[model samples]
Target: MTVIAVTGHLHLTDPTVHLVRAALGRLLAGHPAAALTGVSCLAPGADALFADAVLAAGGALVAVIPSPAYRDTLDAGYTAEFDRLRHAAAEVLVLPFDTPDADAYEAANTELLRRADLLVAVWDGLPGNGRGGTAHMVAAARRAGIPVEVVWPEGAGRRPAPPA
Candidate 1:
């Protein structure tokens, strides 16, 4: 079987990235793909880490940009890495049909999940405050029958976010 897609949250630091990189390496080992082909939104946290890991492992990267001109309006600090991944992506699937409002983010995330066969979530597991919504999306993916592999810091699972 061809390797399925991998999706996850994007909110990791350097050390977290190191751990996550290793986790992904272990998880992706022996997958039958000339390279990994998956969708990443290029967000700073877990998204960038996932994308970077894919490229580092000699896998192809597919960027599912949230909107047409998102790079123009993304956070200042995130621009460079966004640019790097965007340029490095083997192909880009721009969802320019909608701008990135709350509804749009949800829509984009749903689309990301729709294209995936598996999801790898790396969330802090703090309570959701309507801000970072990857946790919710992860739940949604699980409901949709996509296999989910969760990666978090040592204490994360012990403190999962409260239910909606």
Candidate 2:
């Protein structure tokens, strides 16, 4: 059984989100619900979308919140999203402590990857040489010998296409 963990940027909407959802749906189409377990960080955008798809496919949704008192720390938008996930997820696990910043998000990502057999990432290019987000998480997963599935829409980061 594959325990899949999904990590992605929370800033997307509409076509990008739609494209990612469709891509993930297609990628998961052949797997049985019984053979899959899902984990998400419960953020907006891709995280929520992945959880929804997992549920729709009759797979369990395990939400790993960054903090137990997340409502106290998150902005109104994120708080609302967390509440929605509380109701939607079959299981929810709050991290033992709060993260202070980007480092914490990375730590949380590592934890999720540690428990996952597969890591699915949805990333939008953030310019420059920093890799503290989903990109870092994918690299870590690869280093740990877990398979990674990256789903970014066409032109997401401007990777050049092969010549016709």
Candidate 3:
């Protein structure tokens, strides 16, 4: 089976979500359902999109949560989707962290790389927000000798950052 993991932005523009989802679906369609497995942290944007595509493709989903508290830390608007995907996961691995912070996220991303045969990144080729972001995961996957497929569809764009 091919194990694919995803890392990406959490705040994509509305239109970008549709674009990414379609791109991911097309990508996953290349793999036979019986030989496909997807691992994701299920973060709001791209991660959730990837998970949905995996399920839609008849692939197994293994969710790696950074912490038990991670879901609680998601924005209220995304909590329901998070819960739905989490419940649908074939397996859920919760790291031993009480809080959802940078350290926990880094660890979770590490685990994702460790388990994946290939890393599917939904990055925009921009500098990441911070440690454990998409760029960091892509670098980690490369350093570990895993193949990476970046999916940033044409015309895709991120939502503008909210005022500080």
Candidate 4:
């Protein structure tokens, strides 16, 4: 079985979302449906997109929630998508944390890498803003010898980082 994990920005533009979906579809095309498994955190942007593609491709999905209160911390706009992905996951593993903090997110990222044979990074070819971001995870995956496929389709750009 091919187990793929996803890491990316949470705030993506509409066009970027479509591009990401198409890119994921292309990446998953060769793998047999039953032999494919996608791992994700079900976060708003790339994570959610990857999970959707996995399901559409008749592949199993495994969700690694960052914390017990992860749902509570989601933006209202993303609540529906998050709930849908969580419900559709073949397996849901919530880390041992009460809130969605940096530590919890890092732990979740670690678990994702541990379970994945490959990582699909929807990145902008830039450094991550902080510790648990997509760039950090991509670097970690590479350091651990996990193959990472960076997907940044043409014209895709990131939303401005939130003020610190």
Give the worst 10-residue stretch by lDDT in candidate 1. 155-164
Q: Write model 1 residue lDDT over 1-164, tens digit each, in one string.
A: 32334445544545766777777777666565584565778776667877887787677787877778777767688898899999999888887654666665666777778778777777655544352276777777878988877767563332232353
Error of model 2, residue 4, in angstroms: 0.6
- Tell me the tens digit of each residue's lDDT in model 4 across 32-95: 9999999999998899999999999999999999998999888788898899999999999999
TM-score of each: 0.80, 0.82, 0.96, 0.97
Tens digits of per-residue lDDT for model 2, 1-164: 87899977766756676788888887777679988788988777678878877877778888877766555755576677678777878787777765535655666787788789888887664432244467777778889999988788894433332253
For model 1, the local distance difference test gives 0.69
RMSD of each: 4.5, 6.3, 1.1, 1.1
Candidate 3 — what's its lDDT? Answer: 0.93
RMSD to native, candidate 2:
6.3
Error of 2 at 92 (Å): 1.5
Rank by TM-score (best first): 4, 3, 2, 1
- Pairs in clash, predicted candidate 4: none
Angstrom error at residue 57, model 4: 0.6
Clashing pairs in 3: none
Where in model 3 is the C-alpha error above 4 Å? none
